[model samples]
Structures are given as C-alpha cells and as structure tokens.
Target: MLLKGKTVMVTGGSSGIGQAIAIGAAREGADVAFSYWGSDEGALKTKEAILETGQKALAISGDVALPESAISFVQETVEVLGKVDVFVSNAGICPFHSFLDMPAEIFERTMRVNLHGAYYMVQAAANQMVAQKTGGSIIAISSISALVGGEYQTHYTPTKAGLLSLMQSTAIALGKHNIRCNAILPGTIETEINRDDLADASKRSYMEARTPLGRLGKPEDLVGPAVFLASDMSQYVTGASLLVDGGMFVNLQ
Candidate 1:
C-alpha cells in the first residue's frame, strides 16, 4: 500500500510499460485512470487487471497529441477518480526513420505526440495538483536513446531528450509546492511495436550484444522503478532521470 489513497493518471496505459505501470499503481493501492489512443480492448484488459487489485479504474480513450484532449483527460479523470496524486506521462511514439529519408510530416507527428502531448498533460495535471495543495509526483517515461544517439531515430531521440529537460525544469518550478517531477529512461524494452522484429534471431542478437545484461528488456521490468517513484519511497527524489537500461548505455562501445 505504498500509494494508499492516492489517485494516479497514466497516459497510453493500453500496453507495454504503460500497462504494467498502471497495474503496479493499482496494486500499490492507488485509484487509477489511464488513457488509450486506440481501441478500448487493451485499455479494458488493463483495467480488468487493475480492478483485480481492488482499486477503482477508468480506461479512457483520447489522443494525447491534442492539447484540448489532454486537458479534457485531466478534467475527466479528476471528476471520476478524484484528485490526481501522481501523473505518469507514458504516451509517446517512435516511428523509426533515417534522418535523410524521413519526411517533414513524420518529424512533426513524432514531436506532436511524444513531446508536445506530454507537455500539455503535465500542464493540465499540475494545475490540479497545485489547486489541491497536496504534494504530488509527475513521472515521464523517456528513453535511453535520449542520452545516447541512435541510428534511424533522430526524431524519437530528440523528443525523449526534451522530456528530460521538461522534468528537470518542472521539478524546480514545482518544488516549493511539494510536487516532484522525474523521468525514467528505458532501453530496448520488448513491446508489441517491436515484438516481431525482436523475435528474429539476428535482431535479437544485435540487441543482446549491446546490452550488458545480455538481453533486451521486458516491458514489466519498468514497473518496479515506476512504483517506487510514485510512492513515498521516493519523496525526496525529483528532476532525475533513472536509466533502467540493464547497463545498455554503459556497455556501448
């Protein structure tokens, strides 16, 4: 019950790390609200899992890239689940494209979804947290690529990098209000988006060779860190990027 009586909003909680984090939050005794960009199938499944932990759940559908949508999500979540004590900005996209071959539209879309969307969500959530006069936590799901350069991921990397800065600055600005902001930078997590490709032997080998742990990460691997951040265990933590990459960055040669 690390988060007992807390209300948490998780964006893109349909699958992957987002889903795991949502479930983890529920298990920690927090009422949870999660947003999905696509169908409710995945979100509903996650909601079911969360309810099994005996927490109230809300699986909402909306596009995070739209500022209005982000604002509405916050308002709706607050109305349904009460005040948000933790906000997890997990909505992001990574459409791989070579720098030279990438289209302008691709870059714009990535920035819209990955960077701008999270910014707006934070803004909306911060307003609520401040008004409630209760200390809260804001967690951003970034990527290790933000710290290291990656091939064919220029757009994705830059946006993740922006998240780090956003978290840092927000933490500073909100510290007096007892609101903490932080980011988690993951490396090569196995999710639906890359599951098929990672299953291939050659691709698997490439990822294993780079990670010092000798394997790609599972989506659930991010849950523990997320729960710690959301709980009183990390009350003194803020404006930090916890790289849960199994030493992938360190092993890079």
Candidate 2:
C-alpha cells in the first residue's frame, strides 16, 4: 500500500498503459481519478476495476488537447477525490505514417495531442499541487522513441523527446515547491495502438528478438515503475527518466 491515503489522477486512462497505472494505484490503496476522451465503455471498465479495489474512482471525459479541458479535469478531480497526490500525463496518439508521405494534418494533430496536451495537463496538475501546499509527484508516459528512432514515428518521436525534456525543465521550476517530475521510457509495449503494426508475424518476432529479455512488454509490466514514481519510494528521484524496456535499448547488435 505504498499509495495509501493518496489520490492519483491520470490522463488517457480509458485504456492501455494509463488505465493500468490508474488501477495499479487503486490496488495500492489510493483513490484514483482519470481523464478519458470519449471511450465510454473503456472508462466504465476502468472505473469498475478501481472500485473493486475499494478505493474511490472518478472517470472524467475530456480532451487533453484543450487547455481548459485539462484545467477543468484537475478541478473536478480535486473536488471529488480530495486532492491530487500524484498526477500521470499519459494521453497521446501515435499515427504511424511513412516520413516521406506524412500528411500535414496527421503530424499537426500528433503534436497537438502528445506534446501540447501534456504541457497543459502538467501545468494544471502542478498548479493544484502548489495550492495544496504539499509535495507531489508527476510522471509522464514518454517512450524509448525519445532515445531512438522509428521510421513511421517521424511525427511521434519528437513529442516523446519533448516529454523527457519537459520533465527536466519542470523539475527545476517545481522543485522549490517540493514537486517532483519524471518520465518513463517504455519499449515496445503491446497495446491497441500498435496491434496492427505488430500483427505481422515476422515483425513481432523481430521486435521480441531485439530485446535481450526475449519478449515485448505488456501494459501491466509498467505498473510497478509507475507506482514507484508515484509513491514515496521515489521521494528522492526527480527530473529522471526510467527506462523499462526489457533490455531492448541495449541490444544494439
């Protein structure tokens, strides 16, 4: 129960990694509230999972790409879950497209959702923590793409790298208020977003073989790291990037 008595808020939590972290916090005895962008069924399932853990659950439907939406999501969470002890920025989209043939609209939307959305959400969450007068943790769901490259992620990688940079800068700005900021770099997690990409047998095997650990990651594999970042266990850790890639990043050969 590392998060006992704490209230955790998450964005893009209707499914995938975000949903896993939200429920993970609940399992650790924290009240969990999350923002989802119109995934009613997914949101309901996430809420049910959190409730089963005997912790409070709040499902907020809003677009993180809008600044006011992010602000209102925070306000609503505080009003319901009490106060935010930890905030996770996990809302993002990665629309795979060849660099040479990338559509301007697709690239722009990616920037708006992944990069701009995170900026707004993080700012809103930090402001609330400042008002609370208590130290808090902020975690961003950055990816290994921040360190490497992807052929179809030309428009996506930059945003993740931006997230890594965001944590570093915010760590300095928010440290005075005792607010800690960090990013998680996960590698090849099998989620809905990449299901089609990994569906090819050879592609999936190549990806798995690239990892020294011999497998791709599951959404739940990230829970422990997210919990660590959100809990006091990482009290002294800030402005850091935790790479949870199953040794893939090191298997350059």
Candidate 3:
C-alpha cells in the first residue's frame, strides 16, 4: 500500500497504459479518478476493475485537448476523490503520416491533444497541490519517438518531444512548491491505438529485432514505473525522463 490514503487522477484511463496505471494505483490503495474521451464502455470497465480492488474510483468523459475540459476534469476529480496527490497526463494521439503528406489540421490536432492538453492538466493539478501545501507528482506519458525520429511520425513525435521539454520546465518551476514533474517514454507498447501497426509481420519483426528484449511491450509493463513515480519512492526524482522502452532506444542501428 505505497499510495494508501492518496488520490490519483489519470487522463485517458479508459484503456491502454492509462487504464493500467489507474488500476495499479487503486491496487496500491489510492483512490482513483480518470477521464475518457469517447469510450464509455471502456471507462466503465476501468471503473469496475478499480472498485474490485476495494478502492474508490471515478470515471468522467471529456476531451483533454480543450483547456476548459482539461481544467474541469481536474476540478471534478478533486471534487469527487478529495485532492490529487498524483496526476498522470496520459491522454494523447499518434497518427502516422509522412511529413510530406501531413495536413496542417492533423498536425495542429496532434499538438493540441498531446502537448497542449498535458500543459493544461499539469497547471491545474499543480495549482491544487500548491494550494493544499502537499507535494504531488505529475507524470506525463511521453514516447520513445521523442528521442528517435520517426519517418511516419513527424507531427506526432514533436508533440512527444514537446512534452519532455514541458516536463523539464515544470520540474524546475515547481520544485520549490514541492511538486515533482517527470515524463515516461514508452517504446512500442501493444495497445488498441497501435495494434494494427504492430500486427504486420514485417513491422513486428522490425520492432522485435531492434529491441534487446526481443519483444514489444504491453501496457502492463508500465504499471510498475507509474506506481513508483506516483508514490513516495520518487520523491527525490524530478525533471527526469524515465524510458520504459525495453532497450529499443539503445539500438544505434
């Protein structure tokens, strides 16, 4: 029970890595609150799973891309679960498109959701934590793409990179307030969003061959890192980027 009596707020917790983090936090004895953009069914399933752990859970629907929605999401979570001791900004979108083929609208949308949304959530959560005089943790779900350029992710990669910069700046700016901010960079994780991309034999083989682990990662692989960052174990860790990439990023080739 590393997080006993704490409250955690996870964005996009309806499924994938977000879902895993929310459930994992609940298992560690933290009350959980999460947001889903469009999947009511998935949200319900996440809530049910959290409740099964005998921890309180709240799931709301909202688009994090919008500032108002992001702010409201945090406010609602605090209203329901008390105060947020941990805020995981995990809602993001990745659309593969060559730079030449990327449309302006698509690029803007990607930035709005991945970068702008994270900014809004972090600000809201940090404000609450500062007001309460309780130090908190803010975790952003960045990507390995932030470090390595992707041919098909020109637009998406920038958003992830921007998140890294944002976390760094936030860490420095909020350290005095006792709020820790960090980014988690996951490699090729198996999730609904990237399932089709990883299903191709060639793509799967390419990823596996590049990763020293010889396998793609699962959402569950990130649960431990998320819990660690959210708990007291990472009190001294801030302004850092933790890579959960299964050694993929180390392959120089």
**TM-score: which candidate is best?**
2
User: Which sections of candidate 1 miss by over 4 Å?
Assistant: none
- Could you estimate the TM-score for every candidate? 0.97, 0.99, 0.98
Query: In model 3, where do residues sit more than 4 Å from their true spots?
Result: none
For model 2, residues 1-253, the per-residue Cα lDDT tens digits are 9999999999999999999999999999999999999789999999999999999999999988888988899999989878989999999999899998899999999998999999999999999999999989999999999999999999999999999999999999999999999999999999988999999999999999999999999989999999999999999999999999999998879
Each model's lDDT: 0.92, 0.95, 0.92
Better of 1 and 3 by TM-score: 3
Per-residue lDDT for 161 in model 3?
93
The window of 10 residues in a row where model 2 has the poorest summed lDDT is: 62-71
- Candidate 1 TM-score, true structure as reference: 0.97
lDDT of 3 by residue, 113-194 (tens): 9999889989999999998898999999999989989888898998999999999999999999999999999999999878
Candidate 3 residue 226 Cα shift, in angstroms, is: 0.8
lDDT of 3 at 238: 98
Worst 10 residues of 3 by lDDT: 93-102
User: How large is the C-alpha RMSD of every model relative to the true structure?
Assistant: 1.1, 0.6, 0.9
